[model samples]
Target: MSVELNHTIVHCRDNRESAEFLAHILGLSTGDEWGPFIPLVLANGVTLDFATIPAGSITVQHYAFLVSEAEFDTAFSRIEERGITYWADPHRKLPGRINHNDGGRGVYFPDPSGHGMELITRPYGGWPEGSPVVPGS
Candidate 1:
């Protein structure tokens, strides 16, 4: 049997809003809420379970997604349509720009809960062909 990550809880100010926001960007649907969690499952079966926490208790978190070129285009359009600010780099110094790293596009933006969200078409440093650990490995 291979080990896999099933899910992770994302602490947010509002679970429903955060979950819905990500679901829309990824062109996915939110799953039914279970208790305090509002889950957004990815294609790999890894769920991002959003849970509400006090706004004061929330800290900055970074979430990155490896997306296809078409998916990136759609998501980036939504970001622009929503008037969300984005940057080519994580520090957000390069505003209104996108990065072509490893021959793929990437952008960084902040979610409503202030989480640093990233969408990239290629893995940093390129895909790991023989690394000990790859995504979903």
Candidate 2:
């Protein structure tokens, strides 16, 4: 059997708000509930389970997505259109600049819950020309 990532649980103060925030930024749909979670599943079939929690009880986490050059352009445009700030590095020091690491573009931002959201075109290693690079690969 092959192992694959199915979903991840995200604890938030407001599940709906957090789910909507992530869906809006990542260009996904929200408002869908599964059991006790408001899920925002991406095109890759990985669901971000937004679960509600008590007040002042949420820890920030980091999640990254690998996107294509075209998708990166579109998502980056959406990010700017939504007035969301982005940074080149994960440390968030180089604000408003996209990274050109591995000969592809990448940007890092934060979600409503202060979770680090990242979109990268290339992985740590480089990809050959003509190879399809899906978002959040």
Candidate 3:
């Protein structure tokens, strides 16, 4: 057997809302409620198990997804349709824009739970030697 990401718990003010938000944006489906969790499984089989908690008790988290260009286009359209604020940089210095970092498109936004969300078409380390480098790459 090899090591692989299986699942992770994400604390949200409303598990269902958070799960549904991400699912709708990514064009995925959520599993039936199990215990306190609302599961959203990724294409790679990694499930993000959303659980409800007090809003004040929830800690911020960051989740970055490497997506195909088509998936990015679809998800980005959904974000724009919802008027979600996005940035070209994770630090959020550049607003209302997406970065062509690593020779691919990337954007940073926030999830319903306030978790930092990122979508990129290319892995940071896969960038060509002369490609523009984004901070933290």
Best by TM-score: 3
**Candidate 1 lDDT, 1-137, residue by residue in tens:** 89999999999999999999989988999999999999999999999999999999998899999999999999999998898898877777678888777778888889989999999988999533432221110
lDDT by residue (tens digit), candidate 2, 1-137: 88989999999888898898877766778856988899888788888899988858888888989878888888888888888888877776678787677777788888877889998888857434443323422
lDDT of each: 0.87, 0.79, 0.88
Worst 10 residues of 3 by lDDT: 128-137
Q: List TM-scores for all candidates, in order.
A: 0.90, 0.84, 0.91
By lDDT: ranked, best first: 3, 1, 2
- For model 3, residues 1-137, the per-residue Cα lDDT tens digits are 99999999999999999999999988999999999999999999999999999999999999999999999999999999999999877777778888787678888999988999999998886434443444422
Query: Residue 36, candidate 3: how far off, in angstroms?
Result: 0.2
CA lDDT for candidate 2? 0.79
Model 2 residue 66 CA deviation in Å: 1.0
How should the candidates be ordered by TM-score, best one leading?
3, 1, 2
